[model samples]
Target: AENNRRKKLLRSAQKSIMLWDPDGPARKPPRESAELLVSADAMFGLSDSFQRCTSPDFLLHTIGGTTRGAIERAYDWLIPIISRLPDTISRLPPSTSCFLLLRAYGADGERRAQLKELSTPLLHHVQDSLRGTLGEAES
Candidate 1:
């Protein structure tokens, strides 16, 4: 059931992009493709797989250093997933959301700032829970 839903989401995103920009994937610049993907994800709903694809490990170890084409493809997937991250995280269960945000906050100040800037109210709740748990765990 979940797999079927994911396939449908991908198809919806693809169909929308084809209508919006027929040659976008092949001809347009990568940033433009990223924008299309972001719009598509927003319109159709975010894909968990697509969000995972944007992770630095996936980009660096899996997609990076293979070829120009591969890196370009990675960049195409990366930007928009990152752009929609706050929304994505907000939709996750509290524990998972808190883990991701805490990881991001520890890694880069800029990312922490972005999370602060773009976070939904749900995300704030998760953060608060994470803070509460942190103190409990330390005791």
Candidate 2:
């Protein structure tokens, strides 16, 4: 529910960002307020989403519908965008920026593995327990 809302907001904001034209010659130094706002909004949103999903409470509760499968889906969706974000920002060379993205990717993969180690076993246990319970129900 919350995720669906957030995703919609992100798409609308990005669309608005596209509508702004900063490079038009008539523009002054203040520059492209709509696009800048959208970008800032987007960066804030990504930061917030990442923080929320990775927090200890989120790990325990498995909130945000971020199952192992959903997280894998998010990784597939975000990897290219995350890789491009630093390059898109232009504060550093792409080569140096690559290291930051790679490091993040490595750490994230490790954490996901740790989560799966716990989540998968617990899920299997629950399923097995259910099967056993149902078996006895018939006898």
Candidate 3:
């Protein structure tokens, strides 16, 4: 039952990350784009939950060793959205950043290096944002 639950959660995460509207004659409104960004953030949070609920080996197996690729693809999808909303990247919850780092750590050297390259800026952004927030609270 637990395994089934984990599998279901992983599938759901994959589906969320894969959600994208293809370009059409009519462009989506700004609000729809904003909603996509919000959904991506929620998906990241959900991915973090998956990281916490299962062992690294189990997760890799469950996702058919495609977790890294999925994460990278999600990052690609998110960057444009983030560029439009500069503050959005920094506002990502710590769990999302932590999970990315943790997965990087567990990966083989090539994937580890790739994930680190992708996550470094994000980690720094989150750190800076937290510091700024705390500083404001003290003022």
TM-score of each: 0.28, 0.20, 0.31
Per-candidate Cα lDDT values, in order, are 0.50, 0.40, 0.50
Off by over 4 Å in 1: 1-82, 119-122, 125-139
Worst 10 residues of 3 by lDDT: 57-66
**Per-residue lDDT of model 3, residues 1-139, tens digit only:** 9778655645545445333354635333454444555466566865445433434433333333324465454553344433444344444444444456566667776556665565666677546645786435533
Model number with the top TM-score: 3
Better of 1 and 2 by lDDT: 1
The residue pairs that clash in candidate 1, if any, are none
| lDDT of prediction 3 | 0.50
Off by over 4 Å in 2: 1-37, 41-63, 77-139
What TM-score does prediction 2 earn?
0.20
- Report the C-alpha lDDT of model 1 over 1-139, residue by residue, as the tens digit: 9778766755655444433355555333344565667667667765555445535444245344535455345443433454565444333335444444454455456655554554454467576656776435533
lDDT of 2 by residue, 13-120 (tens): 554333326565433223345446546767787444543452443322321342444444444433343343422212222222233334343555654444343333
